[model samples]
Target: MIFFYIFLLLFPHQICQAEVNSNMEGKLLNDLLKDYNKMSRPVKNLSSPLEVTINIGTFESFDLDEISQTISVLLYITVSWVDKFLTWNPEEYSGINQTRLPAGQIWIPDLQLQHTPIGSGMLSTESNAILDSSGLVKHTPPGTIKTICQEMDLYKFPYDTQTCTIEHLSFTHPSNELFLRLGDFTLDQNTFQSQEWQLLNVTSRIEINYYGGPYPFQKHIICLMVKRIPNYYISNMIYPYAVLASVAGLGFTLPPDSADKLSLGVSVLLSTTFYAGMVADIVPVTTSMPFLGLYCLVMMSLVAFSVVSTLAVINLHNRGEAKMSYLQKTIFLKFLPSLLFMEKKSKPSQVQRNTNHKGKVQVETLNDSSKEVEQEQAKDWKFAAKVLNEFCMIIFSAGFFIIFAYTIFFL
Candidate 1:
């Protein structure tokens, strides 16, 4: 019963105090806006332009559409200027030194992107701004900005860096009427990280409009330097092609006498073609080819070539005795085989003398007209086929390493 009486006694006192505080704020607001013109410029001196300092607080969402060549950013920016006409005495208004008001009630500069569509304004509308008794007005407006950027360089994609730009310019006002300056750009640590792209650095500057004509329009440009995070592409696209190419190259080392050599080449070739198709579906459709796409296409072609080379090797292996040309003998049979550490097989010699039955001595002579000479020719043909197989292995191996190495380190 005592606590209920105490609550009843405090209710009227609380209502009276609330009413007094409300009246004080009401009088302060009314006195500040008395005879004030919202549309008029806040400049007390007509000899100089009003200087507005804009500070970029943070960037939340950064999206770069490479296909469209545009960058869209969500900006949290604060613009502040001294409004000379909005000043008031804080002591007369119950020490109310600060207040909030809708931004549409005051005069704000008209801003638009330099590369955006004409007549499309960029400023946010009707947001609340904090006003101080000393005539300082600060407005933080959240807005989405989409602007054209430089052409994306995709030749070194998966290891490429792109520079994109966004410029905010004064649309309706010239440099003499309203001066604009950039304060600083702060990148929050959590928001700067992207899954596919990493923020490398940022640069900002103020430049005069090139198409401003005789009137000078000012612009604040912020350029973002971002690099591609290549881990995803390496795992999904490049690494698999490398492993598939190794499988195809091994077909050249397979023995030509068996069907497994042809089978392996055909299977790997088909697999490469299918995999390349999958990669093409996911990659951006562009007139010029990206480095990764080009690498994949070349790998598919090499796999197909391996299949053809294996067929020729199989055909060359199953041949009968035939004479080799001078070029074939000197180059394929001797010099090239020696470079591959393959020496030509020596011709077998027939027994010159033999003992006959009953322990009696008998003589037999070897001659060039003997049947062994034809057998030796057959052996030479087979040896030459072995040399060609080794040669193809080297060629396929060289091709794989050269393209893969360049893609990894250089491109």
Candidate 2:
């Protein structure tokens, strides 16, 4: 019985409270909207400009199109401005401090994107604007922003960092009536929405533009800095090319008479050509060559030279076992062998040995025929060809390394 009595007592109080709350909200809305003009700007003075602030809360989605040189982002945007005509006394209506109203019925800032081709850069969509008793209106609007970033720095290509900016300019209103600026545009941890790009930072700045208005207009510039993840290029393009270069260098170690030496270099050269075209297709047409592209070109050149050197070495080795000239003996036989850490084996001595046949004292002086001496001093093209192959290997390998380092650092 006590519980039943308590319920009956609270029921009437709850009903009265609900009616009071409803009446308070309805009366507040009615009083505020009675004289509100949605088409006119909320500023009371014509000379005082209405300061509007737009802040990027978060990026729901982000994408970059390399071919088109465009970037698309779906951002959670917050717009804030103070309406001088929307103010009221919070003490008059049950101490109500804030309320929400339809955003389409309020005066919104007229801002358009300078680089976008879509319909006017209106961020305000079907949403509610929170109105405080102090005349502060805060609206959170939704839209996908597409902007062109023409000056994309592709010098580094796959390992490149790109910064794209979206400019928001006031179209209809001059700086005297309305001005727009950026709030805290820092991105949160969830800003990384693109698989190929990493969001490093989001920055914004406001500048007064003087293009079309008697008064200077305000423009809010939003800069998004992102770095490309190079894992894909490293795995598919760079690693394979590095392996191919090593294989081509190993071809020098093969004997000049082996058929695989020249063929190996040719194969590597072909592979390098294919990879260079692949890298060219991966990046858009830019004003300057990418570092990786230059690297590929250098590798291609080195591989081609290696093939030519291998062919020459093979030809020299198989030139009918021809005898080497004096210059060839001096350079390839002596100097080159010393320079390339190769040592030539000498012919065995054919001097006669004294035989003690009858236990008689017999001594024989050493003597060598002219033909034997000439044969001992003879050198062939085969050993010279081997030395040339070693020299080519060292040179081409060093060229590959030098070009790789130059492109990596000096692009």
What overall lDDT goes with each candidate model?
0.79, 0.81
- Top-TM-score candidate index: 1
Model 1 regions more than 4 Å off:
1-47, 84-87, 91-93, 116-121, 278-289, 321-323, 351-378, 406-411
TM-score per candidate, chains pooled: 0.82, 0.78
lDDT of 2 by residue, 1-411 (tens): 999888878798887877887899889988888878988989888778899988878876788888788999887778899988888898898788998888887787877788886776676648889999999999888678899986998888778899999888877788788877668665676655777888888878888878855788888888889898878877787667777887888899988878788889988898888888888776788789887777777778888888999988987787653556788789878898899889977766545555687776555554476665445443456777888898998898898777666644554
Alpha carbon deviation, residue 26, candidate 2 (Å):
6.0
**Candidate 1 backbone overlaps, count:** 0
Worst 10 residues of 2 by lDDT: 371-380
Clashing pairs in 1: none
Candidate 1 C-alpha lDDT tens digits along 1-411? 999888868797877767876788788777777788887678977767888888877766777766667777776778888899888888877677888878887767676777864357567756988889999899887667778776777778778898988778876677887899888678775776467777887778888875636778888788888888889888888889999989988887667787799999888888888888877765566678988889998898888888888887776676665666798788767897889998875855565666777887766666667476667776777777788878877888888899899988886
Q: In model 1, state the lDDT of residue 101.
A: 79
Candidate 2 TM-score to native: 0.78
